[model samples]
Target: MTSTAPAAGAATSGATSTGTSTATSSSLSTTINPTFRAPTPRHSSFTLSTISLCGQPEDVLDLQRGSYALWRDRVEMKLAIYQVLDHVISDVANPADPEWLSLDFIIKGWIYDLITPELRTAVSSPGATARTIWVAIETLFRNNGLARAMMLSDEFRNTKQLENPLSVYIGKLKAISDEHRDLGYPLETHALLLQLVCGLHERHETIGKYIQTEAATLDLLRLRGGQALHG
Candidate 1:
């Protein structure tokens, strides 16, 4: 489904409507761009209501030109916040008439905090949709290729599960694995299993070593280990 990417030209961005849903009319443009509409379902947020900004405004993602990894790291952190708040990057637009409330809140939080006035010219405008800004940021920073994926995979391989919380370690591992998947170089199931098993302490290894139920996926082994740890 079409999403609200950054505008190609100077005109108000055309919307990609879902059903009859439409974008909130922009204050900057008196003439409505009928082509513009809300984005596809944005999977985003925390407990929705309880998502207070605990971190500083500077912690938000930036549009300024920067290193790809650094920019992506910030974006990941921001997306992690959105995920916690129950926003899944699907589409932030409401299924009904697209309320700019969510988009406005995002832009307002981002406007003065992370972006320069020059950068803000694009996103803080009354015309910018959340998804538009979101995609724009990705376009600005999404560096992907064979070399990057290989580097990410190597990082994944080196990321041993030290003494850190199992859940946290697993989350990081899964996140890296997901990046690999998105980049079209996903780890094979067996390769992922080996990486996972490599992280477990000797104690947790026993759970998987003894499990005889058909063939357990690596995820299940991790789950079993978690249960054993908490037990």
Candidate 2:
């Protein structure tokens, strides 16, 4: 009986130590699990550089040979599709915004790539916005006058299918007509159809006669469909 109290005290001390260890372990587990937080599950970001435009435009801007109207239409449509048309058409963001500046730089470089080396220098200036470059290029190519209209009209009438494919020949005529119209001298649809037929090669005589015969009923759309079939 001499050591009974000591043994009981020892057992009580052991039980208390076990309980404290269990409590401490539980506290540490709660703290560590919460702190881990599954590593916050990082998410990637989207930016203009990540965007894909599918491909560059088919037509490059050449004042002497390229159709400005066609090139503009294609380029603008592409920008609109990618939701970046405002970069070239309007100021959609703050000038000081870093993100907008990056996008603008990218678009400016793209515009420069699409034009001839000479036109690039003529349109671009120090710290110029995309809209400024766009307007400058447009002014260079689309300045309308009686002299330009007459020159395009002559080119339109003189176009011949010859060895060129019908599609290409029609494209030339349409481009000339578009430029002439931009000069406030729109040709009549019937007259355009006649010129389209007149420029056809002898091999296309049958279709040309058909177009001439049905001139009143056939529209440009139908004429283009016929061209695709026979092109």
Candidate 3:
């Protein structure tokens, strides 16, 4: 005689021996283009509040772990920021509005200030694993877009020092792109690849101040795409 048992991969329909119930199983579907929803605006001091709770250096590690988990789980936050910025740069309709560009700059400035130099040094150190580098690259890309915007803005011309990290960040971005390529992943994983390449090319002349390249302007043009560059 055959015993009554749920088939493999199927959930029990009713009460179990332990007075527990099971829900029916369904096939799981996966997709590359996950649907992204916008996140609701949180209190502007949310990051600060989280940091404040971590009162000491030892607590900072725990805070970072918790923060990383939150960032990873909150798809809406990533979508509203990085996904929206990606569309803006690609000139997608509705998503490419200039107002969003301004908001991006403002948000980036806040984020950049929040990332202390100590944090940057820690993230970029030789001990940093691939996952650490990936997270840092994501943070930099989200902020570097605003740096590029500031570099192009007339008001920022008077405040050149504020724009210094744009090139340094690009270098780090290129390094991350190279790492992704070496790992045999598609270039799309390095979401800011196109922007980094273009930004490097556009600022090749001035970038020498930050990164001393022996290659001349003509050589730099040849190295990158051989065309007039625009920031």
Candidate 4:
């Protein structure tokens, strides 16, 4: 009762302290800031390094003999590149398109791996298109034409089926035969059949004996063999 109403100065001081606290809180809420970061940029032209291709081009068996080695290596590389570019082979509309650029990049990566340093320098040129590179490779390798074809033919002829099925052996023979035909030398259907028969592994000797008779058709040979196996 003695001090309750007499402390006006103390009441004023308490009011000032509360007001200062409120103002400090308001100042912090208004003045605090947030930071922002910028996004990363991307490259314009499609670019890739050489590690993508699994292996170097297979050397032509004749590489040790003479100039034919160059052709064989290039042909081997061409086949590999064809496989790599199989999807885009049909996409031939615009060279300036991004898809084309991507194809060019892939061709480069595989090519870089396929070629040795010497060949790379020989073929490298500024602003070279993919088609140009293809042409250059073909031109370089096609030098020893008939000799290369003969080598492929010899390999095809000697390709006897050791332990594989007729289908597998025939498939291998067919690939060699196709390349053989591309070089302007073709075997008759009967000749191919004979090769098929002669190359069979000893397990299929019964089927071989059946097909060895005169006037045997490839269709009939497969039919009789399948029936014999299943029956």
lDDT of each: 0.53, 0.75, 0.37, 0.58
TM-score of 2: 0.65
Q: List the residue pairs that clash in candidate 2.
A: none
* lDDT (Cα) of model 4: 0.58
How close is every model to the real structure, measured as TM-score? 0.42, 0.65, 0.20, 0.48
Specify the highest-lDDT model's number.
2
RMSD of each candidate relative to the true structure: 20.0, 10.8, 19.3, 14.1
| Residue 89 shift from truth in candidate 4, angstroms | 8.3
lDDT, candidate 2, 1-231, per-residue tens: 376988899999999999999999997998888555644321121455564443544556776665677788888997776567888888565679766777777777778878888899888899898888999998876563566677777788899989998778877777777776765788888988999898899999988888888788766655665653455
**Backbone collision count in every prediction?**
23, 0, 0, 0
lDDT, residue 125, model 4:
86
Once model 2 is optimally superposed onto the true structure by TM-score, how far is the C-alpha of residue 141 displaced, in angstroms?
A: 2.7
> Candidate 4 at residue 59, lDDT?
38
Candidate 3 residue pairs that clash: none
Cα lDDT tens digits for candidate 3, 30-53: 223366445665433234223322
Residue 170 displacement in candidate 1 (angstroms): 2.3
Alpha-carbon shift of residue 144 in model 3 (angstroms): 21
Clashing pairs in 4: none
